[model samples]
Target: MTTEDTSIEQNDDELFEHHAFTVDKGQAPLRIDKYLMNRIENATRNKIQTAAKGGSIYVNDTPVKQNYKVKPFDQIRVLFEHPPYEYLLTPENIPLDIVYEDDELLVLNKPAGMVVHPGHGNYSGTLINALVYHFENLPNNSSERPGLVHRIDKDTSGLLVVAKTEESMTHLSKQFFDKTSEREYIAIVWGNVTEDEGTIEGHIGRHPKNRLQNTVFEGDDIDKGKAAITHYKVIERLGYVTLVSCKLETGRTHQIRVHMKHIGHTLFNDERYGGDRILKGTTFSKYKQFVENCFRVLPRQALHAKTLGFKHPKTGKQLSFDSPVPDDMQQCIEKWRHYAKHQDAK
Candidate 1:
């Protein structure tokens, strides 16, 4: 028998796994589940059965039951919603700022500059490493990362919800997937936003030329990207920058950053999206020096995941949590506030 295993990485919020196999002409008939068990690594019988139930197993393009007999020359394929984890999970003695913990789940405040999970070029000191060490037998998500339901960017500080049991894992994942959960972010963007409140809608996808960034597609090319929506309200208007609260309707990768940039208000100091440089303000050397000082104060993007609301997985009761803005971001905001006030008084 010959087997081919393939994994494709996507730039979006979700990842999938695909596998294919061809039965040898001389092979005898065997149960499809058993045949897959012998060929696929780390696949448990229960897992295979669950995949079969979900119609993820197929023979010659037709979904099949686990007990179906595999015939010679049959084309078998298996699809999974999430890809297998690439790196081994190791426990590390990293401290976690846990906000709330119960039998089913926990919510924590993750600091900036911390990767959520291990991936290429980042093999250690991840949130998953800390999770494995602090808790025992935490449930694995579809991607096989323990307890993770969603993630934020490495440089974006935010709140995250984690599952402790299998039931909670399945339940909480559904809430995110169905867009029933509420998430609010606070961001300081470069420019004075004219509107008090508005909604930005566009298709968000990977940038064709730049693999590291995502862009918004519109009009005739809308089909190229997935639909994303962000509702933003002006919280305060600085002289050259604006503070806004953004509510996510669809949790696409970099949704707020891309959508805001599409409208010409990129997040302040977000280096990847070109917000690190002086996008607004006068050309005077003193003004330039002041902006540079603000950049140094907030080295990363001025965005924070401030509020999260979701239904309790086990009890079906509603729960909400809020986090205070980190000190660095708060200090930077204060500086901008003072600068705007001084400019108005002059």
Candidate 2:
């Protein structure tokens, strides 16, 4: 898998950029920070040094200090947290599924594969770019993602609320920060969960070995990452896979995905978390073919933002919205239901 962690959404306010380079065989030995500054535009030696100190710079898969020399054929990779690209916010007329619209706010169902905002490789055709073209005078936060109070993963389909005015933005953001906003997600994960309802409580942080994915941290290392909590209830059992609903108390990066995987039930088809293969079920040829078909039908993670509830930013009235699962997920679930039924008969 080619690092789909870039597609995962995080709670951080800053956007991160990842870059990689291969040193030439005849390359001259130089300080890694100096070499990176020469290749990357707008890069300062201080910024590169900071990234190295932060453990975001790697030389040949090993974290190296800024003063480390670049050797011939050395593979260099760097991940840097940068402010959103201010100059890249051009209005593009990409279509949006606007479910509700008002002067102060707009609620929309974002489809899978459409990034919420411009970041790194995705500069155009984002929800923010569409909002900028469709609406006027949206509030611009510190980052370039204008009016976005929260975000869903790029491969997770679901509902999102965008603030239209500064007052609404502040009010809505406070609701999310306070954990008062109601957000529910529906997911299909590999294996049958024995628990009817359970809560996953742990600290979530970036993986120590692979910075691409999030891992649950336990023991006395409480300060390593922010506290995250997810409550889940099994909705249905479909032999190899189970449908479940998750409610998040803390919206950390990849919270649901990471928590579910921690319990040995990775999300169905979530390639980034090792759910794309046959995590469960028999190894018969027919079963293997059936799973391959399911993967084909649902190419992305089998998760969706189903419902959202919060107080009205201006009116002080409670508001809520719900969406049906997308067609692809619906169809995949039905296929599993049929397979499970047939397996029972046999």
Candidate 3:
């Protein structure tokens, strides 16, 4: 059986997906776009050509144009900053940590490292695949993402709700759109936030240079981005890191991460936003080694989607759910507590 190699990579705030395929011996020469269309589900010619123009398409490990012909036994690869929409979704029996389930909707805690839905290089083993396999006739709002009202990042563990019917999907979506739903996140960020409570207001949009990241914009240019607001309160104080609870007013892509970074407290271990490095702390070798050990314990961003509240679509009753911080993050926090106490003694 032929196997395709796929990897998702991020570098210097740039996101890229890598896909490699080997052509069959009997394959005939064909335009690269056409060839990809036949091989990659839901890939349109325009999208393929755009990627080619962006230097994201490759053949035999070399960049190629959309018209580059594919020959028999040739190696084909493609790289893109974003995952294209997936056309086909196959259900898989992946276990889910379902928090609550009713006829109208179901709430579940999404673990870290599990994609909320399939896209780009992630075609399977997603929450959507598991939901489809476990339930019947979940609603899709004219999109591939079925029953989703909103989405959290794949690496951020959290609570999410999925609609079981169209009415529920519409109602829940409207609630999110109107900003009536309540969502709270627990995050550990570098640097001790000076304020006990504060609100972060910014116009958030894609970074001008890095397509993989979002940034805060202001003044006339602020009109180019969406308005985003995050209200945060200090939860705990570690020596070099502060734990904060963030509540969203307007949900934009990476809103919390961007807003926090704009305020000079990047989420701990959030490599995409430059938090993985030693942003705050002394340059001593022992301090550096301690930070490295903490990084090893928590490999992803120190954020958790801890609480969600919304009115039920069917019953008009309020519903809420909460999830504890996962083990990795908890352990990392404990280590920091010990280190901070040790430092205070010196």
Candidate 4:
């Protein structure tokens, strides 16, 4: 029997272009995902894994498993939907910590371990997913993400704002885009900063090769990365690490984490981009072993958006709110302080 086949010629609108391979290879069997990878080159295995979950991909003109065997007379076609991609991020019944709310906007003290939005590797249990399930109408104007103004990293806990209406979202988004909203954070870093207060200046862009991380480099064009500015001050000195307050002059992806690392003082739990080398010079080395070992108990990033202040996009009234660090962070700090004092006595 002759099998009919269809193929999609994908465009490179996204970072990488994909072309679908389909044929009437009768009576042979192969895993749907493996067959595509074998036929396609430079295609990431992870990307294939994501695409296989959807319905558009099929084997023998019928959808099958990523590991499904393709018959010899199978017709394979890839229907690549480019624009207006369907959102697979389903809403889960995750609890939200609300700090302040109004008709236009809401301020939530987003907890650690909660993903703010849906992206690769995460399809559920996200803030956006929850918002969708909760709000009857949150799609701002005509956006896929409803009521989202800004987002915090999955691990870093702090204040986040959500716009309940399109008009409000447009106004609030402008504030962040124009660098008018005031954002403040408190963090524990590995060592003492020389000046009580200072600024870290660097252009933050994606690590050209490493798709998962951001870096500080001087690039002539803005597309490489947006300008990121972090102003910080030392609040108190720990035995080895310093607890500091940070303010954002510009908001970029992972701005604080990247800037703190750039200044040689990565946040306490930010081992990914921050190294604890700040302990080299100071008396922290006295309890260096303990310093390293104690804070290590807290695995998540040691940063918090303690406070957020913004103007009402609709009411024209000033709105501000502050969030205290969760008990874990406080405990981490206290443990470090107590250990340092005990070592100093010895």
Candidate 5:
């Protein structure tokens, strides 16, 4: 048993949390750095690599590097610098839409327009806040962010998983590594897709000149991006806009929206990517009215996480959940469909 040592006190700036976690097969045999990347939410491989090289990572009491292989039963220690908020604020109750719940995990249908967590310039109304509030007794992914196993965009409503226990979080996260997790989304695009089904395979990376946009390039470096694959089927073609079911082959930030835009079909009302043409409502009254009335151009990308499936981390049970499109998106589709039909009749 380790003895308490509060005699050595640290200042606010000096007190970084040291996390201890066990390695299971979900983490075994992979490069120690990537394994750490797999185990932690939002922590990347580069972060782990830097920590290992800087002696902030220890496996069984020895500092290791990227080459170290994780093994079951190994006690991994990570000394990561937690921001000042870690110890200062406990997670508070924020209302959340719970889709499914078990002892090990909880699946939430996060509404569009809720930030996943509090970050720079954002101090309130985030998914993590809700997780913390709801799972008040549950441990966090680390000491800072509470319970989040994965995320969806603030304005993209869909299924998200929060781990109730550390072991479950670790195991479920590896499914993402093995590409076994089932993630499906629904998106409304600006143009109709003639093809009933198709796949867009592109190398997606940061924009060359426009830092905010994602670009698909053919060059070898391709900016060293992950090969992003999106399998999409036209679910409903409303003459102008279309509802598409998107199955993610690889998960990336802003993936579906960017990939669709790359294929000349940005999401309906994506001001950032589609610019003028998609947004200009010369005569679509319902859309124009919405823009001019209650909601402005501020609606989020019309993407929804309709389904997510994965094996239970502790029990290995195949778990799946599905949700209908939200009311706003439903109204958008119906209004667009009516306008398209009227235009066609003319």
Candidate 6:
């Protein structure tokens, strides 16, 4: 048997685990689930059955039931919502801004500077830590992270939904994976976007030179990255900077920051993507000092996950939530507004 394993990262934080196998020509017929159990490490018959029930197991591109017999040379594929957790989670009694809650799921407004889940060097003070503490028996996404469905950057404040039950986790994850969920972000970026609105399309992947950053790949190198689409419209112009609303068609790590920068409008104060150094303003010392002050006020990247919408896992009702811009971003925007007004008056 030839086997191939793949793990794909989706929607910034969602991870999909994929496995493919080609049956040997001489292989005897066996139940697909049992066949997978023998080939995949640590896979249980129950887990394989669950994957089949979710229609995540395929035979020759067609979803198959657990009882289906694997014929000789048949192609088989399996998909899991997430991978195994890398860290042992410790529940912390951290405060959560619960926006809305029900028996099946809950929505919370995550503040900036908070990590979504425990990871290398950030094992504590994460949203997951807080979640496990506040709630009991929260369903683990395939990754073993309890309650988490999706995530934003550590510094991007926004609304996120957490599943309280296994059914909810499966349902909500399907919505996000199918691109039926809606997510919108508000950002303050350097430069006056020449167009009132536009769509940015490019493949996003890790930078070749900088391991910490993600960059856009175009032309012949497009295959090097994942396809990403961002639709942006100007909300307000602030002279050297602009406030914009970005709707994501596809979510990738640093999609907004990378796509905006690709168009010459790096997010204001985005230190990772080079927005912290006044990429758009004048060289005058006074102007330089003003930009520096704005940077200090915002402190992090000027991006926020402002809105989230999804279908209720059980009820099938469409639910949407919006978050107000945080105070630091508000204050920084005000400063730029004043600066823009002053420049126009001159």
- lDDT leader: 1
Q: In model 5, what is the error at residue 319, expressed in angstroms? A: 1.1
* Global CA lDDT computed for model 5: 0.72
Candidate 4 wrong stretches, greater than 4 Å: 1-86, 141-143, 219-223, 274-296
Candidate 1 off by > 4 Å? 1-86
Query: Worst ten-residue run, lDDT, model 1?
Result: 1-10
Per the 3 Å backbone cut-off, how many clashing residue pairs does candidate 1 have? 0
lDDT of 3 by residue, 203-257 (tens): 9987654446789999878976889999999988999999899999899988999
Query: What's the CA error at residue 79 for candidate 4, in Å?
Result: 9.2
Q: Judge candidate 6 against the unseen true structure and give its global Cα lDDT, from 0 to 1.
A: 0.86
Query: CA lDDT of each candidate?
Result: 0.87, 0.86, 0.85, 0.72, 0.72, 0.86
**Please, what is the TM-score per model?**
0.76, 0.78, 0.78, 0.73, 0.70, 0.75
lDDT of each residue in 1-346, candidate 5, tens digit only:
0111112123443324345666654433768776655445456678778878887676786778888887877877665455423333446677777878889998888888788876433556777766666666665663345676667777788898888887887787778767799999998887767789999988887654343466787777675467889999988887667889999988877889888888778887665576324443467666666444313432667889999999999888899999999988887777767767887899
Evaluated at residue 68, the lDDT of candidate 4 is 69
Candidate that scores best on TM-score? 2
Poorly placed runs, candidate 3 (over 4 Å): 1-85
* Residue-by-residue lDDT tens digits, candidate 2, 48-78: 9998998778777677999999988898876
Query: Per-residue alpha-carbon lDDT of model 6 for 71-185, expressed as tens digits?
Result: 9889887755654333557788999999999999999999999989875346689999899889999989876789888889998888899999999999999998888999999
Candidate 6 has its poorest 10 consecutive residues by lDDT at: 1-10
Give model 3's TM-score versus the native structure: 0.78
For candidate 4, lDDT tens digit of each residue in 195-270? Answer: 8999988888865434356888875645667677899999888766788999998988888888887777877767
What lDDT score is found at residue 328 in candidate 6? Answer: 97
Q: How far is candidate 5 from the true structure (C-alpha RMSD, Å)?
A: 11.7
